[model samples]
Target: MAGRAIVVTSGKGGVGKTTTTANVGTGLALAGRKVVLVDADIGLRNLDVVMGLENRIVYDLVEVIEGHCELRKALIRHKQLDNLYLLPTAQTREKDAVTPEQMRDLVAELREEFDYVLIDSPAGIEHGFRNAIAGATEALIVTTPEVTAVRDADRVIGMLEAYDVKDPGLIINRIRPDMVRRGDMLDIDDVIDILRIDLVGIVPDDQDIIVATNRGEPIVLDQRTRAGQAYQNIARRIEGEEVPFRELAESSFVNRLRRLVGIGNKRRKAN
Candidate 1:
């Protein structure tokens, strides 16, 4: 069966789109699914770097599209996971070098072999983003719990709707419970209220993510980090499993207690 394609995108830079793609791909591959992650950043590609496969890239997406190399040759297998692969973007080529049609065709061919195709989109609503989402069956919008990030996320959602893409899920990244408790930052609820999309995961701000990214290792491999667990949960949710969203530490204890005691359950039942 052909696999589903998901574009991991964000309207603003520094919102963790590439990180989300790497982690989600790793998490799914860890679950034993054959997965391919495509870096759609074109000239500013970093997905290969994030995956620690930059030094091994002889051909890239542009080379495949331009018939300079076979698609299989451009694909670099993961060093750790046999089933995980990466189709890196060309750092020397511009985004316009490959058209949306080429991207669609490439993804179509990849779907025949992999169980999942995850595209890491470049930041912005431009040609790179368009190409990234061209053949996607779904989209995962990554954003932080801040007004600016949420605003950009809302814009991205509107753009997706304008493009006729349905069911784009949201992942709130880099949330700090302490800041939210101090009313110094927007919480997940505020972000969801503004974005109005299905919540996939809430990843807390963690220092380990930085260290892992620096080492070309995705934090999902740690399994002990909160951000790692959150990414893993997002992967499971993408696989159509019903995983509950994690609660913020700032939420009222009374409310949390009530939730644990099934008070909210009764309210929903009554409704």
Candidate 2:
């Protein structure tokens, strides 16, 4: 049977779209599914770098689309996971090097073999982004808690809808519990109020993500980080699992206790 082709995208840059893609792809692969991470970023290609497969990229998506190399030659397998592979993009070519129809065709071919195909789209709603979502059956829009990123993500969500990609779930990246507790950043409710989309995952802000990126390793391998657990949750959600959203965090226990006793409110006995 053909598998799902999901695109991970964002309207603005630096919202951890690539990071989400890498970790989620690895998470699904760890579930024993055959997976492919396709980098549609073209000239700004970095998915290979993120996947730690840059040196293995003798061929890329462009080569496969243009017939310069066979599809198998373009797929660079992950070092740790035998089931995970990456179809990198060309660093020298422009986004126009591949069109929407071409991308759709390429993903169609990939679905025949892999159980999951995850495309890491370039930031923004331009040609690169269009090509990235061309073949996607589902989408994960990543954003930070900042206002600008949220606004841009809202726009991207609408664009995805216009493209007939319905119900693209939201993955709020880089969420700081401290900031949210202090009202310094948009909380989950605030973002969901504006976006009004199904929540997929909330990746906590973690410095380990940077270290893992520098090492070209997906954070999912390091089970200690909340971000890693977030990606794992996303992978399970993708597989039709009913994992509760807030239950992923330890704070859920505290929040539930607070709710149970109404401790969050001031006492009214003195009134």
Candidate 3:
């Protein structure tokens, strides 16, 4: 059977879209799924660097799409996981270098060999974004608990609906339990209420994310961090497992409300 293609995107920058992609991709790989990660943000590829395979990239997405190199030559295997691979985008090339049809074709080809293909989309609704989701069978929208980020995520959700991507899920990243308790930041309830999408994951604000990124290691490798656990849950959820959302250390009013409405706790119990 052909594998799945997922595009991880956010309409706004600095919302941890790429980080979410890397972690979730790695999480899925660690779960024993053969995976391939595509850096579709041409001219600004960071997925390779984040995955710690930047130096090994001799050929890239453009090269494969443009027929300069075969797909196998373009794929750089991940250091730790033999089944995980990276198809980095060309930093010197523009987004227009590869067409959407080409991207779709490449993704279709990848499906023949891998169990999952995750595409890291650029932050925008422009040509790069189009290229990123061209072949995506599923979508993951990443956003921080902020008004601007939520607004942008709403816009991206609308676009995904227009594109007819299947069952797009939301990832709420950089959440601060303290800020949520103090009413200083947008809570998970507020974001879900606004976006009105199925929740896939909630990543806590953890400094280990920075340390992991700097070391070119995915946060999901940490095992002890809540952020890592959150991603692993997300990967399982994506695999059609009924994984419950993790309750924050101190359940906020929002968490209580979610349970009271049978939106979170009751559903989790039913599942």
Candidate 4:
């Protein structure tokens, strides 16, 4: 049976696309699915670093597509999960290094082996973006609650529709409940109203995501932070599981104090 090839992208930069890819891929692997994360952002590869597989990368997507190395040789297995792997892109190669046809063919080959293939796209509608979505059977668009991010996400959704990638799900990242309560930022309903796509996940503005990235680990493995829980739910949703979205309430003074004092810090890591 063939596996699913899903492209995770955002029209604008700095919208946590790569982070979403790493966490969701890890979460799926934790669910006992054999997964491969393909870094399609040639010349600006990041999935490896985000997953802490940077040092282990000897071959990349360009090399595999170009026949310089075998596909299995290019896939670096995850440190903790035996089923999770990463196919990093070559940082020295340009976006034009791999054509859409080659990408589609590569992903077809990947589908034969893994249960899921998650492609991390670069932030743009250029050659890299086209190549990234060429092989995708489904798509996930990541965006923030900001107007600019939502606008760009709308543009990307249009482009995806043009390419016949229908019904791409939306992932709202870095949402601040406090800001939404104060009317300082766009709320989830507002963003959803604009994009008009099925909401897949909503990640809160948690500092633990930054800490996890700094430590070369994905936030989904922790589950202590709200953002981590959100990513895990997104993974389950991807598997066609009916996981309900959580209500993100504004943090109270006592909750903030509890977090600060580490009084309620014991959170069971998601398996």
Which pairs in model 2 have colliding backbones? Answer: none
State the displacement of the C-alpha of residue 178, model 1, in Å, after optimal TM-score superposition: 0.4
Root-mean-square deviation per candidate: 7.9, 9.3, 7.2, 2.2
The runs of at least 3 residues in candidate 4 whose Cα sits more than 4 Å from the true structure, single-residue gaps closed, are 250-271
In order of appearance, the predictions have TM-scores of 0.90, 0.91, 0.91, 0.94
lDDT of 2 by residue, 1-271 (tens): 9989999998999999899999999999887889999999999988888888888879888989999999998888888788899999999999999999999999999999999999999998999999999999999999999999999999999999999999998899988887788889899999999999999888888787999899998888765555666788889998889888852356645645764676543321111
Deviation (Å) of 37 in candidate 4: 0.3
lDDT of 1 by residue, 59-174 (tens): 98999999999999999998888899999998888989988888999999999999999999999988988998898888999999877778888888888888777889999999
Worst 10 residues of 2 by lDDT: 262-271
Residue-wise lDDT of candidate 4 within 30-94, one digit each (tens)? 88999999999999988899999889999999999999999999999998888999999999999
Off by over 4 Å in 1: 247-271
Q: RMSD in angstroms, candidate 3?
A: 7.2
lDDT of 2: 0.87
lDDT of 1: 0.86
Which candidate number has the best TM-score? 4
Best model per lDDT: 4
Clashing pairs in 4: none
Query: What is the lDDT, from 0 to 100, of the residue 193 in candidate 1?
Result: 85
